[model samples]
Target: MKILVVDDEEDVKSLFEQKFRKEIRNAQFEFSFAFSGEEALTYLADHPSEVVMILSDINMPGMSGIELLKSIRKDYPAAPPQVMMITAYGDSQNHNQAMQLGADDFLTKPVNFIELKEKLLKTL
Candidate 1:
């Protein structure tokens, strides 16, 4: 499965790389990273059908995850890729907005990879 992960934090690339090392090595999961929502959008334009899921951070510097989710839903309304929004704050407002925007799932920051893996499995 191919998953595109978007976050402003550069270290997120390394974190996911390390956490999913076994899956990557075994070719069970392939991940791509984007440091901003615009970057993620550019990537989507290049590989529209490649990504199976998107894991995005809600509090990005530009183009928040909610905006990205809205765009994705609008652009791919037929069968959009599953989106899972992540945020450091577990506030109800963000959660509610993400759901209202059509997020498939929501996750809090300091993410638990085990839980994330389980969720990913179900999503796939």
Candidate 2:
């Protein structure tokens, strides 16, 4: 699976890389990183249809993940790639908005990799 992970914090790249090292090495997964919502959009635009899933942080400096999700759901209306929002808040409002905006799933911050892996397995 090819996944794009978007976050303002650069460390998220290393964290995901480390967490999914085994899958990556086994050629079961591929990953790309975007440091912000804008960057993620640019990447998606440039690579159209390459990414199968996106894991995005909700609160970023420029565009929030909810905004990003809305854009993605609009632009890729047919067979849209799955999007999962991750946030520190874990509030009901955020979760409801994301689902309403067509988010495929939601995860709270300090993500539990084991659960994430299980979710990925079920979906992918």
Candidate 3:
């Protein structure tokens, strides 16, 4: 399965890639990255089912993760990907909004790689 890890931070992107490298060998996961939500959408439009899950940072420049989730839920309703929102703050309002927008899960910053892996496992 393929997973899209979306975040503005370079370190987070690098960490996710490194952490999932071994799993990629087994085809347990193939990873992709998007520095912003709009880029993520563009990537999805081009690759479609190549992605199974989207791990996104909530606060981003062009489009927030919330916007990305809503767009997918609406435009790709038939098989919208499971979105896992990531943020540094645990804002209840954003959390509720994410849920309403169809996010499958949420994670705070300083992403725990192990937990992220398990969550992706559940969705895949």
Candidate 4:
């Protein structure tokens, strides 16, 4: 599966690469990184039907993940890519908002790789 990971943190790319190294080596998941929500939109625009899922950080600098989620839901209402929002703050307000905006799932940061892998497998 092709997954787009969006976050403001530059280290996120390396972290994901390290965490999912085995799956990547096995060709189970293909990942693309975007440093910002705007960049994620650009990537999505360029590769409309390529991405199967998006893992986005909710508290970004410019456009927040909630805003990104809203835009994606609005733009691709028919067949939107599955979106899972991640955040350091596990507040109900953020979680509720994301759920209302059509988020497929919500994950709290310091993410549990084991849980994430299980969820990804379920999707497959």
TM-score of each: 0.96, 0.97, 0.92, 0.97
Cα lDDT computed for each candidate against the true fold: 0.92, 0.93, 0.84, 0.95
lDDT of 3 by residue, 1-124 (tens): 8888888877776787678878887888888898988899999999977788888899988898888888888878877777888898898998898888788888887878888778777766
lDDT digits (tens) for residues 37-98 of candidate 1: 99999999999788999999999897999999988998887758999999999999989999
Task: Give the lDDT of residue 37 in candidate 1.
Answer: 94
lDDT of 2 by residue, 49-103 (tens): 9999999999999999999998999888875899999999999999999999989
Q: What C-alpha lDDT, on a 0 to 100 scale, does residue 32 get in candidate 1?
A: 100
C-alpha lDDT (0 to 100) for residue 104 of candidate 4: 98
Q: Counting only residues 3 or more apart in sequence or on different chains, how many pairs clash (N, Cα, C under 3 Å) in candidate 1?
A: 0
| Deviation in Å, model 1, residue 10 alpha carbon | 0.7
Scanning candidate 2 in windows of ten residues, the lowest lDDT window is: 70-79
**Rank ordering of all candidates by lDDT, starting from the highest:** 4, 2, 1, 3
Pairs of colliding residues, candidate 1:
none
Q: State the local distance difference test value for candidate 3.
A: 0.84
